[model samples]
Target: MAILELAIGFFVLAVLAGIFGARGVAGMSMEIARLLIIVFLILAIISLIL
Candidate 1:
């Protein structure tokens, strides 16, 4: 849940940065968001299986 929220926050930050023309920040945030979401999903799957 916390990871999901962090991913969402990063996604929002990426979008805002993109709007403001901060390409580097936007890219980095987007990458972070993607990684967090992937981690969250993996953890969720593991929890469900175990």
Candidate 2:
């Protein structure tokens, strides 16, 4: 699930980059990557705790 989201995020970023600009793509991709990392860590911790 997490991987899928991350993949989609990157795909969107790539498309946006080609259509719009590098800056927008970079910003969005960074944000998505950050969020994905956070979520992935949280899920890992929760699974370990349980």
Name the best candidate (by TM-score): 1
Pairs in clash, predicted candidate 2: none
State which candidate has the highest lDDT. 1
Q: How do the residues 1-50 of candidate 1 rate in per-residue lDDT, one tens digit apiece?
A: 99999999999999999999999999999999999999999999999999
**Cα-based lDDT at residue 46, candidate 2:** 93
lDDT of 2 by residue, 1-50 (tens): 76658857776776677577687777777677777777777887899999
What's the true lDDT of residue 1 in model 2?
Answer: 74
Model 1 scores a C-alpha lDDT of 1.00
Per-model TM values vs. the true structure:
0.99, 0.61
Poorly placed runs, candidate 1 (over 4 Å):
none
Q: How far is candidate 1 from the true structure (C-alpha RMSD, Å)?
A: 0.2
Output the worst ten-in-a-row residue range by lDDT, candidate 2. 2-11
Decoy 2 TM-score against native: 0.61
